[model samples]
Target: MEDLDTLVLRTALRWQATGLPVVLVTVARTWGSSPRPPGSLMAINGRGETVGSVSGGCIEDDLIHRIREGGVQAACATDTPAVLRYGISADEAHRFGLPCGGTVELVLEPVSSRSRLDELLQACLQRRSIERRLDLRTGQVELRDGRRDGVPRLDDTHLATCLGPQARLIVIGAGDLSRFLCQMALGLGFEVVVCDPREEHRASWELDGVVVSREMPDDLILRLRPDARTAVVALTHDPKLDDLALIDALQSDAFYVGAIGSRRNSAQRRERLHMHFDLPEAALQALHGPAGLYIGSKTPAEIALSIMAEVVAVKNGIRRPSPTPVVTGKSLHENPGYEVT
Candidate 1:
């Protein structure tokens, strides 16, 4: 339903009494490469207002144009669910600016109060995860049980998606890089938390929607218990603070624990954690020394972007092209001194 489609979709449905027409777009499939993944949702209002995205921009642009032509007016008759595809050839790919040889398919469904979309939205809001079994034959949806432990799962007939709530990012400093990283992470749907115990760092900090904490990094890491969906980045590089938090994080389930430093410094940090705290080689490897993809990122924002890419790749079961996988500290090779299976 529109509510399951985007947050804006729910707002549209809830505010329908205010009388505004809305259109919804969903990404159904892709081939070769695509900017947005399948299951992504976007919504547009009668006035060309938009929320979320399907393609990088081109598809959204095309959708916007269609809305202007009265594509999704509420007064229009309901449409049977339909599957739409884009970018079948090289020229089309270039026209849409899809990655070379890219193709994407989508499902567009119009919703009303009488539609089952409202039901689906309510079910989703009530549970950590829920499967809306769609009747392709009748378009009726049935709600089923789902899981919230670890990664959530959605095994539905029409689509399979696992949104484990929102990912959390805890940055242990309020420096320029942390600011950039916080913004980048927030855009990617991470609940960004910036922790700075120092007043100097907190005074000048001015990132929006980011949770600022004054607790010590180590204490905060333990409290947050960084889950598999969580990413922990230490930017201060101060062992007195960062090291303890890194130690605590290494023992938890955080998917990514990284420090911004040269590889050499990471090696030194490893030795210290290994000797002082007895952090095994396994845990140390998960400490992404030198963080970020090796994509030649130099600026604070770019570095933040690269690191986010790596974090996302790991989180989404996306295969990393690099030879060495970002170790999760639980891998066998990371444990030369001991064994954890």
Candidate 2:
């Protein structure tokens, strides 16, 4: 499944291509508390159809009402883009269902040939990060190199935002745990690939959205050369398969490299990598052994949930503290008196 941002852009482009008057709305700024952050995208068509979201239902309803009432011109006001603000007053905040004192500013651009949304979407499809600079005065856009995870910048005359590759997950195994992990990752809009050289495991691997590969784990890792938006998780519990994949993933730019195992096994795997592979301390430290936030998971599905949660946390720049580690939870479970030092 495509990520939300990509879905919005693709749908908007389709709407425009069909000669529907579409307005692309971007959340350019926010204050106090907001449902979505800056760079959030939404598209509304002349028929009151919408894809994506800027705020909760209230803001989207307002946008739809405006478009349905005054065609596309209501959102943009003219050929140039328009800036609209909501929740500027206490009453307005309540009406808009924004948190108290919350406010959001949006840029509404009427979709047109000059928008160059097709090129922007193409760049994203090709996994190339590009910044889209919107000339608010002229409604023309410029594309340049940018980070996939960049912040949106709004200035007096322009709105600059980055769009890049979808986050991807490489699972180094094919089993029940990997099955659940792949399913969760697909639902979360990640492009998932499952690799396992074991024919018995590969023979049974059939998931709808994930790509299944029979390549050895290390070879798959090397071939993919995971980028910053990518994540790698080893789940086979076999040292030969998991260890090599972990080594390559840790050395790469993958934002998350992890393995699922017991605390003891996790330590053993790390030792094996460090002792035999000569992996640097930093890379070893980067590995998320016993991957996942400790959520008392026992079933395969629950385990996948925990691991995917940690992967998403790390991807979103959230670092859980010491108390949340699987080791901490397992230790406490194993010994009632165990306390984190």
What lDDT tens digits, residue by residue, belong to model 2 across residues 292-339?
777777678878888899999999998552544335346422221111
Model 2 RMSD in angstroms? 3.3
Worst 10 residues of 1 by lDDT: 332-341
Cα lDDT, all candidates: 0.68, 0.87
89-114 per-residue lDDT for model 1 (tens digits): 99989988899999988665554443
Query: Any runs in candidate 1 off by more than 4 Å, and if so which?
Result: 1-17, 32-35, 46-49, 56-80, 85-103, 113-132, 137-157, 187-189, 262-264, 294-309, 312-341
What TM-score does candidate 1 reach?
Answer: 0.69
* N/CA/C clash count, model 2: 0
